[model samples]
Target: MLKLKSPQKATMQITRWVSDLDWRLLLLIIPSLSVLVFLSLSSTPIDSFPSLRSFIFNHTLLTSNSPDFVNSLPSGVHNRRESSVAKWKDELLRSRMAVCLVGGARRFELTGPSIVENILQVYPNADLFLHSPMDRNAYKFSLLKMAPRLASVRIFNPKPLNETESQVRVLTAANSPNGIQGLLQYFNLVEGCLQMIETYQKRKNFTYDWIIRTRVDGYWNAPLGPENFIPGQYLVPPGSDYGGLNDRLGIGDLNTSKVALARLSLIPKLDSAGFHQLNSETSFKAQLTTQHVPYLTKRVPFCIVTDRRYGFPPSRFGVPVAALSSPGPLSGAKCRPCTAACQGRCVAGVMRSLYKGWSWTDWDNGSLELCNARDQWERGWEKIFDKVAGKKSASVRKKFADLKKKECVDDFNEMKKRVSNWEAPPPEELCGLGLAV
Candidate 1:
């Protein structure tokens, strides 16, 4: 098989091998040239390819339901939020609103101005109805003179309530330290304001489109917007459910509010429905549910400002009081001011341990700061509140703290002149409770 070939035959074979190698190389090069030509003709910029990939990657990262991602959203995302709020504001301008504020005015000096600016002034057409018990801190409410509209104001002395049989049977004294009498008084405060609204409506021959119920002790960091006004459903704040909807702040159409605000009148219905041992919030839910009323919840930008003390590093059943300066839409949770003992992972661990149906609030966004709250409000809290609440709000606080009895009486007189119904004690009695003789 190892036979030698002639020189001319070997030359011919080598040439054919060289020609086959060239054709194979051409086959590989032609496809690449075609691709390059196609790209060029399509006018695709070389830099644009990576940009397209980056855009998709960023969008996916942002849209994922990660808490961290949602908290630290991109700036463009904020623009979209601003746009939505603007739309909501426009709708609010068209609606007639009533704001019913209840509870004692313990910290109205700190809370009043913000309520005026963020709520009443924002809705200039809104009618404000105030129902509160007279107390040494009552003079602080003089700051409400800044409100754009005043419908009715009542500041009454605390009186012993005769708890009805139905109230005793339906309500629980377990969490209410003041017992059944406390529940009766609170129910009276809410329903009394509703009564004022009805009388005013009857006088004017026109009804409000919306009714808002909030607390006098509530400190609002932001304006209440129109998104809370659902046409068919009552709206309440999201957390501290206590086996029911949060009754600290509520908003609804007039029809829905009639059902929501009838606190005392609904007890008989609750009794018939076999609901018992219910706290305020639970009773509220029962009343609505039994009436076939629908409700929705959203996070509101306010806290139930408090001076009460709770234990530090709270137990599972204990309440976690937030710091006043904490950047939170506290949503009606109890709060006070102090150096924070918990945040981030510590907060998550503590919140997870607590009952969500009880004292829990939205703590994942780093918006909440915990306070030891083992003691009363610390010294120089005024300065701290002033710094965080801005100069305008601080000025309001200072004015009220320095309010004299005479000035307080004059302000009450002015408030009396403004309201259609002023069913309260005389200005002297109202202001004297707070002012030193």
Candidate 2:
């Protein structure tokens, strides 16, 4: 039998040999040997080669034995599956529809222009249903000619009735069947909206993917971005959640519409569910919660312009007086066109004092101002309007030219850009109380 050298002696001999060899040649030979050994080891089958199998098995044990491996793998799988499900649901819900219900006096005059110019124009794909107690003045909204489809415009001649009488009239007529008197009045409005969807769907042979419900007199301050649509959730403005969802804005799949439009009827379900004396907002919130419906709130860009007035130092019991000159296309809530007594620092202070949880968001850091335009429209409001209009209107074009000749072009342009980009400082910024974005 040939005698093999001991391990230590063998290693010493190899080291001495390497030390004597050309360094470059030794480096090349070492890497080449490493590659050959790796291939030979890898090619050996597990069962046939005990040493190689042991090496691989030890590596496998090291990796699989890690506590994090078991913990993380399941979590990764779950997240991936959840992501896939959400993607599928979003795609399925993309074809939904929206319904805008417009009722009340001066619906056209106060809100029609802005709706036509901003919302309806931008969202041409949306269906518009007008249910107003008609007045001859409704004719003034020829601009609404652009609506993709207009559902029935019911013109009920509302007799001057007290609050109780009006409520009863509205409720009874909304419930009536054929004579357009009771529940039918409300049903007509709801059905008219549904019919618009049905007509469009039948014409296209498809169902709408989503529906949005909003009031006619609600003026929009910003573009309604598509990001507002959340799957499996109805969305409304935050402050207006009045207990249920804000009856003002509702966005959901067809499944939600069936429950939401049964407004008067839902009251019984609410009362049956142990709800009592619920106000409009609260009742709306109850309907969703009781039905196990999910909902979300976003800051919708609108203001319900009201005409009610309250004294300064607004009594803890004082009603909030919103300015009509409130940089809005004023949808008819109620508004007074008077100069904001609460300007500059005072405006910032009042906005800060507002109950954020109940009223408005951080008031954009107090930059919001109420232009009480009831007593008088502000002096420079026309100029401000002209600046914002830019080349959109011929009148604005003329105004811009006159201002340019007066050497106010730079200042005007700066202000116009700020408004255009919505970069105006929040009320807090103007007051130097907080950082402005």
Candidate 3:
């Protein structure tokens, strides 16, 4: 360097000085170089220039947007995720239903068997709530093993409770403004069903899809098909409307159920809503109409084999005519060839009395008749269950006995076939000789 060095030698000497720098100093220099490179790349906006800061910022923003990242961000973010997930789960599980079974426990041996066999058996997924005031024979009736799913409350024994007991048991008031016994009992039945819904919701963390309220004493003359489950509406029997909805068989979503269940409270609402002189059936109708709940009526394959008696030519407002001798694989609403004791022209007229805007011409006259079963039952109906139940042959008798024990009448295989074919047995076969009332 003292002598005038060449340009190449001077360049080599500068390089050597850089190479001789300490490792720690070099490490510090590397970061300084990186920063310079980053700044240069960022400032120079070329079409192909890769900017480290821009790339890093974009990746960081994307990570922040991700659920996993959001969940991990902080305590606040994690809590938010948990809350959102919980809400979603609750919404997913929310459903509407409240099954209610009412009336006296008369004919429970026959009716109970049919319910467990046909209706309840097929709807294993359903909630089965019962409200019959049990009689002395209640203990004799075969309680279905599956009943616990719907009846956590004690089976209603129709005994009069003391004032304190009544007060404790009374959950809702009757829809009747006057609070008649029938209406009060009905209210209690509905209340029990509501309690069931609440208990089920709490225990299982799920709600119902629909509540099917029917009588325990009803004998299913046929299967309870899935077609009955109408969307956003309640369903009931056709001929029993009586200017109101049939409370006997109610298929309702939760909203309808809520209005239907609020017995005493519902009356004031109905009154405020401008309704008057509502009977049980009419009140049911008012409840639906006032709450804007829609309903449908279909023939279910069953009848309320009543204890009452009426003449062949029924009074103008007489009891319904049902066939004593029916060979029914009856579609719940098919009343073909039916004769009426009421003042109506045909079964359609009977149905119209109960349900407005009902078209009953579709009823099958040949398939059904309205005969009084109470008289027959009182005479020798014990033989009827034995005969139809096929008590003769070992295999047939065994099957019948099995059905009796299980309380399930619609054999799954037979049900499947009927559903597939949509072919019901002829009324003649259902009503003739051995099948007759």
lDDT scores of the candidates, listed in order: 0.78, 0.46, 0.49
Q: Candidate 2 — worst ten consecutive residues by lDDT sum?
A: 428-437
lDDT of 1 by residue, 93-150 (tens): 7778899999998888878887888889889989999999988888777778889999
lDDT of 3 at 375: 41
Cα deviation of 205 in candidate 1 (Å)? 0.4
Per-residue alpha-carbon lDDT of candidate 3 for residues 1-437, written as tens digits (9 for 90 to 100)? 13213322332343464457653454467565445444444434453232233233222232234445565456764675456545533432354434566656555555666676666656555555554454433332333433423433334434442333222233223443434555656667676667666666777787766777777666675656544554455667765555555566666566566666766556656666666555677777777777866565655667665555444433454444455344543323222122223322554555444323221212345444455322433444455455543333223324333343122322322332322121222223211212122
Better of 1 and 2 by lDDT: 1
Candidate 2 off by > 4 Å: 1-96, 105-107, 158-205, 241-245, 310-313, 317-338, 355-362, 373-437
User: Which one is best on TM-score?
Assistant: 1
Higher-lDDT candidate of 1 and 3:
1
Candidate maximizing lDDT: 1
TM-score of model 3 (CA atoms)? 0.55
Q: What is the lDDT of residue 132 in candidate 3?
A: 47
